[model samples]
Target chain A: MQRATLNRMTPYAFMAPAAIVMVIALLYPLLYMVWGSFRDWNPAQTIGETEFVGFKNYITLFYDPAFRESLSVTLRFAVIVVSVEMVIGVGLALLLDRNIRGMSVLRTLFILPMMIAPVVVGLMWRYMYHPTVGTFNRWLKSIGLEGVDWLGQNALMSVIIADIWQWTPFIFILALAALQSLPRSALEAARIDGATPWQQIWHIKIPLMMPVLIVTCLLRLIDAFKVLEVILVMTEGGPGLSTEILALRISRTATEFRELGVAAAMSNYLLILLLILTAAMFAYTKIQEAREARIRAAAEEDM
Target chain B: MPTIRLDNLVKRYGAVEVLHGIDLSMEENEFTVLVGPSGCGKSTTLRMIAGLETVSDGEIYINDKPVSHLEPKERDLAMVFQDYALYPHMNVAKNMSFALRLERRPKAEIDQKVREVAEVLGLTPYLHRKPGELSGGQRQRVAMGRALTRDSATFLFDEPLSNLDAKLRGQMRAELALMRQRVHKNMIYVTHDQIEAMTLADRIVVMHGGYIQQQGTPEELFKRPVNKFVAGFLGTPPMNFLDADIVERDGTVWVTGKGFELALDGEHADAVRAHRAKQITVGIRPSDLSFDPDAANENSFELRVIVSEYIGAQSVLMCDCGGQQVVVELKSETPIPLGETLRFSVNPAGVHLFDKESENAI
Candidate 1:
């Protein structure tokens, strides 16, 4: 009995260090944030001195128009940037997945943008999108065209374009890897089955690549929701909250507005949203695995 | 059915040419099997015909129409890959109907054709299952069903049965032969297995080192191989070759080796009289060596038996003649003790002589 109990506890003993680290580094802060979300506490006062105000901060932020505007802006930015990046990235991968001279060098160059620091990417795009004295305006003037306001009137569009330019390579590299690992004989069989190049991609390649593309899209979506550095460096949420994503709002709420309790509440809300999205993805994979297991069982039974 | 013709087909990758110009033609409903060892350019030639590989030079014709530049889909051909190559995402029915669906055939017609082919292939019960859920033999049947549903003018198989187990390969080979009888199309198959080539091919094209060594009916190639490679490649207990010299002893042409001297008569005698090569190689099939205790010493070989491999009803004896190894097939019931020198008479008709320098049958 003692040996059996020790064997059962062996795995837990091995995982003890990681579990302790996760509790101290991750779960404690999450619990603290959730605990503080219901209080009317100021940053200057200790938590024991604060008054217990249940759900007031959460209720206040729920009806706040600026918070609602910031949330909408974040949702819009994430959806648009993620969709555009997915299309351009997967398209580039399909186009470049071949054996040609200098293809490795070309692929390396294509992924260079994703390697740069986010702040540097923001600075680089800010200069390029400058109204008068930058690359775009200079090129426009060279072509005898009047300069247009890039970051001022089109702040959201400028930030989105910058984010896409810096991040599309993330999807490109992954999609290219998935495309390369597909079965070569299946493609040949499709060719022999009278499928044109476009039909082959539509009927075989894309269906086979769906799982990878889905996971990549979800990862990019989660990253897009929490993006802050590039927009902070580029626009600082100016032009009336045009480029203010949820992460920026959370930062501004804590630091500038001096509402630590409200900020924690907002952080908890964002965490919940992310948790739901992650759970959905997990459920999808679980269902897929179950279906595959059932099919394998059927095959074994027949054999 | 279209008569497919390959006129001087060649394949080259950069400066290295793998397939020399190969010229061949297939009749309307003939089954042509290309048999060769690895790197013999058999697969390259098949891929060139299937348009999976580009032709470096030469022209391909289907019913007298040039199709060298056409894509695989445009050639009206269906291919069964060695791996079976069934689409994992599609069910058996959908896989069988893929070509018809791509051609925009009527849905009812596609369904009917798919059902007919699936029934014929004994895949009716698994029509709704994906390729991953089927056994290897079942997947192979689905691949064949897919090819049959296309009803293309030509079918190309690249070692389809090479991936199966020995027993399953035999079963599938028999099924393929039965299908060949029922489906009369221009079929070109490639394999390195000599037994498959002998069993299934209406015409066997033997290749070596990117060149056609010989091509003829299975019996013709087996009985009368043009060169040493084909002779040694296309037999089970391969033909035994011995270094010998042809000489005219007392107005009778004879081949004299280290431990045996065999007199040539009939066509071989006439050919030896006209031939000028003194040093030659004598080829004899293992089945042609018969034990004859009272045979003359000049017409018989005294070999020391080393090992006996008993394979069911027949047994093969590994013997040493002078210094060369020879294999002989005999009935397993023959009482022959090991480690004993025995006399085995050579059949006159089975004595094949080739020029030593050229290794070409004389």
Candidate 2:
């Protein structure tokens, strides 16, 4: 009896370290932020001294036009970037999934951008987008064309393009792996079934790759929502809040405005939005698994 | 239906040539099966005809039109892969209707075609089930249904029923033969199983070592095998070979070896008389040897029975004839005790001769 009891407790003992880390590292800060969001607190005051304000911070944020504009900017940035990146990434994968000389080397080079540090990518793009002396302006001037302000007029788009450039490679490698793992015989069958090249891609390749593509899109959206470093370095949320995404706004509220409670309230709002997305991704996978299970059950029932 | 012709077809991979110049012409609506051991270019030839592989050297003509450079879609052919390559995402109905839908046919017409073929293949009940949801036999039927839905001029099958269990394979093979009779398009099938070829083919192409060894009807290849390989490859218990020499005894030719001698008929007298080599190999099928207990026939041997394997109504007895292995297939009721020497008669028409050095039938 004692040995059986120990066997059952052995798994729990092994899991205790992870459970403690989760409580301290993840759950503690989340609980602290939730509590802080209900109080009218300054950064200088301790939690015990701060007085509870009862939804005042959330109410102020709802009425604040600057916060609303930042919210819209963040949503628009995530949508456009994810859509464009998925298309270009999957398209590049389909195009490059073949045997050729130096193909593995080429694939490695394509994914090199994703391996670079994000801050370095931001700095590299910042130099390229320089108005007077950068690569784009210099090339434009040498070609006898008028140089437009890359950072000033098109700051949001410039930041978006930079994010796509850095993150598109992540999607590319995954899409390539998915493409390579597709059954070779099915493609051969499709060829013999009278499907043209375009038809094969539209009907067979893309439809078969839909499951992986959906998961990839959701992950990119989640990453896009929390993006801060590159946009912060390139635009500094500048050019009159054109590129001030939600993460940047939250950071500025806590540091520059010295409003800890309001920043925590804003963070909660962003967290709620992200929770919906994460839930949708999980729900999609669960529904897929359930469908497969039901199918197997039905087959068994038939037998 | 278009007749298919492969004129000196060749396939090369960068440096190595897998298919050295293969030439074959198949008649319209004929079931031509390419049979060979592995790496013998049988599958490669079928894929080339299906337009899945590039013909590096010669041209393919369907109904006398050069089609080597045409795309598979343009050539209008459908293939059943070794692995039933059903669309795992789509249900059976959608899977079968994919080709028609791509052509943008009317919805009613597409539904009619899908229903017709589904019924024919007995896949109607599983029309709403995905490939992953179906059993192996059902998936095999779905593959056949997909091919039948296409009205292509030619059909290619790359060992379509090889994945099923033994009993299921036999059942599916029967169904395939029935379907072949119902839908008579130009069919090219590839397999290593000689039984599959002999049962279903209108013409059999025997391939070996990147070359075509022989091509004829199954009866022709079985009765008059061109060389030693075809003679040995086609039978169930397989042909037995013994080292022997042909010599003149009085006025007739006698095949003399370590075991016994057999008199050759008048028809093969000159063929053996003019042979350049002094030594030759003799071939005999297992079914040609009959157990004659009375022991009163010419060209009869005393076969020592060693082991008896009972297979239902028939039993096969393994025996030794003068230190060489010989097999006899007979009814199980004739019981001779083990270790008993019995007399077995030989049929002259079943005797085959080959040159020892060349391994070719004389």
lDDT per model vs. reference: 0.91, 0.88
Candidate 2 TM-score on chain B: 0.96
Off by over 4 Å in 1: A1-11, A46-51, A282-303
DockQ, all candidates in order: 0.55, 0.49
Name the lDDT value of residue B210 in candidate 2: 84
For candidate 2, write residues B202-248 as lDDT tens digits: 99999998889899999999888878888888877788887888788
The B-chain TM-score of model 1 reads 0.98
Give the chain B TM-score for each candidate.
0.98, 0.96
Local accuracy of candidate 1 as per-residue lDDT tens digits, A111-161:
999999999998998899888788988999999998878889889988999
The Cα RMSD of model 2 versus the native structure comes to 3.0
